[model samples]
Target chain A: MKFLAEINVMPQKEILDPQGKAVKIGLQNLGINQVSDARIGKHIQLQLEAGSEAEANQIVTDACKKLLANIIMEEFEFKLIQL
Target chain B: MKFLAEINVMPQKEILDPQGKAVKIGLQNLGINQVSDARIGKHIQLQLEAGSEAEANQIVTDACKKLLANIIMEEFEFKLIQL
Candidate 1:
């Protein structure tokens, strides 16, 4: 089976997202001032070959923990959908 | 009402994502070879003040169309959750 993992990797709440802040400021400058607390992170989409749903989830978990996300500064979560 | 908008900005499929390609190569170098078509994008989380869910959605849609995404090279989608 082929599983698609859509992952969201975000900066820890305690971590400062300079790029996010910059974008927020950019937005404010553009006169769209209603949005705040803008936080930026990464969205990763990957396809994997797995025998079962559990295996696909496990592979994604490992990929997130070991490669896709930087745990020291960022946190991650994902949704799996078969494609 | 306070609402949270979770947005994903991704490179258009026809566009080349060098950073994403680099990350995929990095993964293979780390011995994770089961993954393919690795793509990278931005995850944006923001809080907004809106009178209703529909209003909030409009605000987010405008944000995505105007500032958060580059339509020529990237595409964006979002979900709004009340908080």
Candidate 2:
């Protein structure tokens, strides 16, 4: 079975995102005024082959902990689609 | 028109990615040895409303510069789909 995983990695809410803040300020300069909040983050797509959905979930979990996200300063969430 | 953009942001070739290196070593430990290289990065999906393909492209470009990517250490590429 093949699975497609969409993962989002973002700085913990308590942690300051200087990059995001900088971008938000820049957006204000660009005259797009409706935006009030800007949070910057990363999105990851993973394609994995597994025997079952359970196995695929395990793989994605491992990938997230060990590779895709920084556990110290970041938090991640994912949704899996069987393809 | 609506467009779906898949954006990949990666470290510049000149930059050293300690995270990616750690992942490569960890994968080798998992007994799945076919993997020789690991590069860690981000994927972003954008849902945009536009009047035409050309306008959509411009919006994407602006978004990339202003929000979606870090031009200093990262690079991005996107594909647009009409919906």
Any runs in candidate 2 off by more than 4 Å, and if so which?
B1-83
> Which candidate leads in TM-score?
1
Model 1 chain A worst lDDT window (10 residues): A28-37
lDDT of 1 by residue, B1-83 (tens): 99999999999999998988887797788877777878999999989888999988988888888899999999999999899
What are the DockQ scores of the candidates, in order? 0.80, 0.16
The TM-score obtained for chain B by all candidates, in the order given, is: 0.95, 0.92
DockQ of 2: 0.16
TM-score of each: 0.94, 0.58
Candidate models: Cα lDDT each: 0.89, 0.70
Indicate which candidate wins on lDDT.
1
**How many residue pairs clash in each candidate at the backbone level?**
0, 1
Determine the TM-score of chain B of model 1: 0.95
lDDT tens digits, residue span B1-83, model 2? 67765566877768887776776577668654333444567655555667788987887678777766689988778788776
